[model samples]
Target chain A: MTVKELRETVKSLLTEGKVDLVIGWGKGTMPGTSTPVFIDTAEKADSLIFDSTCRNNLSVYFTKDRRALAKDDKKIGVLVKGCDSRSLVLNITEKQIDREKVTIIGVPCNGVVDMKKVVGKVDGKEILEFTDDSKKVTVKGREFELTFPLDEVISDSCLTCVRRDAVEYDLFIGEAREPGSDENAYAEVEEFEKLDSEERWERMKQEYSACIRCYACRNVCPSCYCNVCFVDQNDPQWIGKSPEITDTMIFHIIRNLHVAGRCVECGACERACPMDIKLLLLNRKVAKEVRDRFGSITGTGLENKPAMADFKEDENQDFIMG
Target chain B: MIRIEKERIDEFIRALMETWSVYAPARDGKNTLFAPVEDPAGIDHGIFNTDKSPKEIFFPHSEVLFEFEGGEIKKVERDARPIAVWGLRGCDARSLRLLDKVFGSAWQKPDNDMFEDPYWKEKYDDSIIFGTACNEPRSTCFCNWFGAGPHDGAGMDVKVVDTGEAFILDPVSEKGKKYIGSLKGWAEATKKDVTKMKAAAKEADKAMGEVFGMDGIQEKMADLFLKPVWNDIGAKCVNCGACAFICSTCHCFDVQDEGKKGKKGKRIRIWDTCMFPIFTMEASGHNPRDMSKDRLRQRFMHKFSYFINNYDEHLCTGCGRCVIVCPVNLDIREVVREVMACEA
Candidate 1:
């Protein structure tokens, strides 16, 4: 949808007292980025924008530490792309948020740009200005100007995203397109699986060793809403606080398992990670397993129970019995 | 002053590495950070500012204070040689000095070594800091806000300026002077080179533009401690430690004990931040900074008010790492402006 329509819709929601707050994306201080903006008044609704740089999953506000945003009978209006919508649905199914209190305004996303990929494309030049026309992204630096196909710099998750439109929304701003082809959804995972076990372990170690234990990945994740995360539980701490390879690996593995059937594949964790760890590789692998084993796609339906949450008598038990 | 050709910069780094364990900005996977330089060719001098700050060179993310085995405590050993950092920006150089006040000496009692941190002292006390002039400061850079510029040589042994074809290294400290005197095959910096260096510094300072007036920020922060401005300023914060972790001057850390069973363990200190809710949680389940806004307020207050109250300087160096990495884009620059504009 056009940004004008999105703003008008949010304005009406606040003006009509339908929602107390509208959470959306605003222009970020940095080029090729957007920040989550909380709009509470009709006048503030104009700050909302939906573009490739709008990478944050605004649904994260509905859970855990941010639950106060929806407290006191306040109806919250949230802008959701496909992944964000799934996160909201997951939150609702997990009983973390009341669906009644949220007004989901779905924006049909083409995809979000990965700023790291863009920077890499420009050979690490400082991007001063960034503009995208959906088909192409143009970045200008002090000495160079470059334009590239949108697909080239789009987030890795977006390349494999089966759903690019919200499955559940109170008001969808754009026309809902059919789900994207899933033929190449697990292509990267399949390639990763082809590697020998030792090679995979080495790759995992190399990737996670770079982690500074900042917890940006965990903090940005909507699915990771535990009041006291396992990593923070000092009473019987599961892993060392240090970014030791073993501890970092265990943290990632446990977190991956924790969100196995619930992960929305939003790519927020990977994007938020300052270390630029390839977090989605393992997450998508677990997601693929969930999809294959239980025929479950997370957050696609309100009535569906998470694969890990639901138990069936006749479901596949080959792993347990074979 | 000493001069080294731009193409032979690696040889200079290699020379420094012979005596000191050199740390420089280098490519580590997708990010550039300060890493140990065994091969001088691996050092990347072209980066504007590293993705992660050079603070990790002195104060690592995690440091084992001591290891214990059946009541016998063993201190972690380090290389006898001191450290030498290459290509640190002015902001990071200043950050180290700011941290040194806390770690190098007891601020309240200048003569007392009782409050000094041994681990930080061991690494940083004798370290030679090579402050590089940031000729092309990024848009987010605001070192000028804190009475600093891209070329401010506040905490450097040697001030290194890239004058296109060669580096003009000016000795700023006694150690730097002696070190430069010892180095061989380095030419004396000519008048033209000094002029180029000065011109570059001028252009970079001009590029930094206007400095935010921080005249009464400390007082304003104290006055607005219990005000609603914090709620507005912290509305979009995700309560992540990204900003604190990436910051050059954020020095808070938490110590934890790890063991195999209860027989043996090592006490380790890891980086911590007030951005986390648990950072201020009490044993009795009472948290002074329970809300995200409260934790967020503490970060700003400590940076602007409490640190200034203690050390007569703001804790922030305005390196702008937080400005770039914030997922929600709660820009600290805008927050500072908002705080300044707010009425108590």
Candidate 2:
């Protein structure tokens, strides 16, 4: 849907007093990026936009420290892509956010551009101008101008995303398309599994060694809503604060487990990572396990509990019994 | 005036590596960062700024201050060779100088050596910094706001200008002059080369466009400490350390002792940020900065007001690494403008 329609929808929400604030994407200071904008007044609604550069999952605003934004029983209107909508549903099921307090304005998604991938395509030259159509994305720098197919530069999570439209939404802006095929959904996980244990460990070590331990991935994640993250606890100090490979690995592994089955594969964590670490590989692998063992997909419905949260008599017990 | 051909730059770096532990901007996976360069060919000169600042060279994200076992404490030491950093931008170079006031020298307590950090002094004091001129400053760069520009040579031993074909290295410090005198295969910079460097500097300075008026920002920030604008300014902030971790002048660290079974332990300092709620959390479980806005305000206040009051300058160098890395796009430039325009 056009940004005009999105703004119009939000303006009415604010003017009609349906919501106190609308959380959406606004033009970023830099090219090929969009910032999360909070529109409290109808006039501010004009700042809202929806496009490939709208990478942040706005549902994070409703949780943890940011929960103060929705204080005084102020209702919030959040624009959500397919993955974002799933995160919202998970928040509702986890009882972190009230379903009644939020108006989910779902937008049909074409997938967000990974700026890292774009930079890679340009061989790390600074992109001065960026434009994208439905079919292709173009970037221009001083020395080079390059264009790539939209799919070529979209996030890897978006490539295997089964749902491009929200499963649950208060209002959807455009006609929802059929869910994409799940055939290659776990393709990366399968490839990861192909490696021997030693090779897998080496790969993981190499990837995670680049981590600077900024916790951008955790902070940006919608599912990681713990009031006091384990890493922050000083009494026992679960792990060392250093970015030593062991400590970093522990942090990532624990975070992955904490968000397992709850992560909607929004790619927000990967996008937020300043180090460009492949954070999604382990997350996607856990997601694959959840799907395979529990016969469940997270955030598909308000009624469905997370795979880890739910219990089933017929569920696979190979992990425990083997 | 010394000159090194663009093709022979790697050779010079290799030569420096023989005596000094060289760190330069190098490709680390998809990102470019200041890393130890064993292969000079791996150094990336194309980047306007490294993904992370050169601050980590002296003050690492995590550093072991000392290790202790069986009632004996041992200090951590580095290799005998001093640190040499290549491809530092003018902003980063100035940031190191600003940091030196805190780490290398105890500016607050000039007569005392107790306040000085030995780890920082050991690496930073004797280190040679090769500050490179920005041929094309990025849109986010705002060193000009702090009365610094792309060609600023405040903290450089040698100021380098990349004139497309060759590097015009102007020795700014005695160390740099002596080093250049000792190095071989370096030709004298001609008058044309000097003219080219000056033109490039002018173009880069102009490209920075306009400098924000930061004349009374310190006073403005102090006045606005209790204002409601912080709510609007910090609304989209996720309270992450991305900005602070990437920042060059953000030197706050937390010291922790890690031990295993009460046998052996090491005291280490890890990078910390005011953006995190736990950074201000007290042992009694009471947090002074309980809200995200409070934490967010602390960062800006520390950078703009507190540092300015103490050091007579803003802690920020306007390198724009924080501008690029903030996940939510809480642009510091916009926050600064908003602070300046606030009615407080």
lDDT of 1: 0.89
Model 2 bad stretches (over 4 Å): A68-71, B106-114, B181-185
Error of 1 at B175 (Å): 2.2
True contacts kept of each: 0.84, 0.79
Give stretches of model 1 more than 4 Å off: B106-114, B260-262
lDDT by residue (B41-160, candidate 2, tens digit) is: 988888779888889999999999999997889977678799999999999999999999888773757455547788998998889999998989988899999998999888899999
Query: Candidate 2 on A1-322: residue-level lDDT in tens?
Result: 8878898999998889999988999999899999998899999988888889999999898887877555558899899989999998998898887888889999988989999899888876789899987679999988788888999999998988989888888998988776776667998799899999999999999999999888999999989988899999987678889989999999999999999999888899999988889999999999888888887788889999998889889889998999
Looking at model 1 chain B, report the run of 10 residues with the lowest lDDT sum.
B105-114
Give the Å shift of residue A319 in candidate 1: 1.5
lDDT by residue for model 1 over B194-214, one digit each (tens)? 999999999998889589898
Q: Please, what is the TM-score per model?
A: 0.97, 0.97
